[model samples]
Target: MPTLLLVRHGRSTANTAGILAGWTPGVDLDDTGRSQAAALVDRLTGVPLAQVVSSPLERCRQTLAPLVEARPELGGPTVDERFGECHYGDWTGRPLSELALDPLWRTVQDHASAAVFPGGESLRALSHRTVAAAREWDEKIAAEHGPEAVWAVCTHGDVVKAVVADALGMHLDHFQRINVEPCSVTAIRYTPQRPFVLRMGDTGDLASLRPRPAHGPTASGDAVIGGDTGDTGTP
Candidate 1:
């Protein structure tokens, strides 16, 4: 068994501008986001990460920079596209207000398992791939670093939500009920029986959440959301 730390990238330029970043390129951390990234080092001070994985996108990479710099023993982050942001396809860089008015918006809020972006992936597909990828990595890390191994994966908001939903044994449609803020940390430990979620959308200390034995375990709709943080807006 291993402790998997799920981290949502910090706020970005797109977030402040109210844009949905999706897989869009050139999205970097905003001033506030840089502060959040820097603060992450302190937050994760005592947690020893055997491996640091990340989405191949810019924001996720930027978010992990500080941690990578501070934790040299962990080397660099291994990029895994499966853990990347859900493909929005045609909806990739649109405004949240515009997307809210789309016919699919209600489905996203109500029955996410059935909601697929016009030219992109479905929510069900998202959960399937992300959940599988997490477990695969968990097993690999455990074999390589030992059962007490601890790892961190820096990914997107919806991706984080989907993983959390699966760990909680909730249906995909209810994944929207979870909200993870920028730089938040969500930890899950996989055991022979089930996955235990140690923390959910935590924005505080990681010292308390350090690797242990088998443990148990944002936004939008009324407001707005992004792939990086609130992944509800665009590039």
Candidate 2:
């Protein structure tokens, strides 16, 4: 099995302003976000990452910049559209407070699988593509670098949540219960039988991702909880 590290892009301009950036072009990581990305270098110090993959968004690219600069051996980060932010359509760039008043908001929070962003995409579709891309990458990495290989995927908060939901065998509607913070790292290992979630939205050392000795203490934790309404303002 190969380990996949899912990293949400650090906080962006929109995040701080409570605006839904969606697929907007000019959104970039704020100063705090830059520091957060830089800090990941030390946290991931010893992990033998095989490669780095990122969503083709400016914020995501900026989030991985420090890692790429620190570890050139990992090769330049490759852009993967499958992990890009969900298209919010009419809701793009709207304020979270305003979207909360929409009747569709409740359905998105409670019945996400059936909720489609006006003029955009369905949460179900987002889950399918994100999970499929992860599986494809997992197989590719395992074949090229062996089952012990580890890689990182830099993308949006919602995308990370979707992947986590699938790995947990949860329904799309239930994905709202997962919370992925800015610059946090979630990890999953894919085996022949099933995918195992090693970590969820961790902002600390990744030493736990390394293989443990038989007698070593095991890593255990609980999942973070929150509701995501598929609104552009979520982080």
Across residues 28-125, which tens digit of lDDT does each residue of candidate 2 receive?
A: 99999999999988888877789899999999999999999999887789988999999989999999999999998999999989889999998888
Each prediction's total of clashing residue pairs, residues at least 3 apart in sequence or on different chains, is: 15, 0
How much does candidate 1 score in TM-score? Answer: 0.90
Instruction: Tell me how candidate 2 scores on lDDT.
Output: 0.86
lDDT tens digits, residue span 1-235, model 1: 7789999999999889888889999999999999999999999877778999999999999999998999887788999999999999998889988989999999999999889998999999989999999999999998999887789999999999999999889998998899999999999877776777778999997786664333222111121222222121211
158 Cα displacement, candidate 2 (Å): 0.9
Candidate 1 residue 23 C-alpha distance from true site, Å? 0.5
Kindly report which residue stretches of model 2 are placed more than 4 angstroms away from their true locations once superposed: 212-235
lDDT of 1 at 93: 86
Candidate 1 residues lying further than 4 Å off, grouped into runs, are 213-235
- Alpha carbon deviation, residue 57, candidate 1 (Å): 0.4
Give the root-mean-square deviation of each candidate in angstroms.
9.6, 7.8
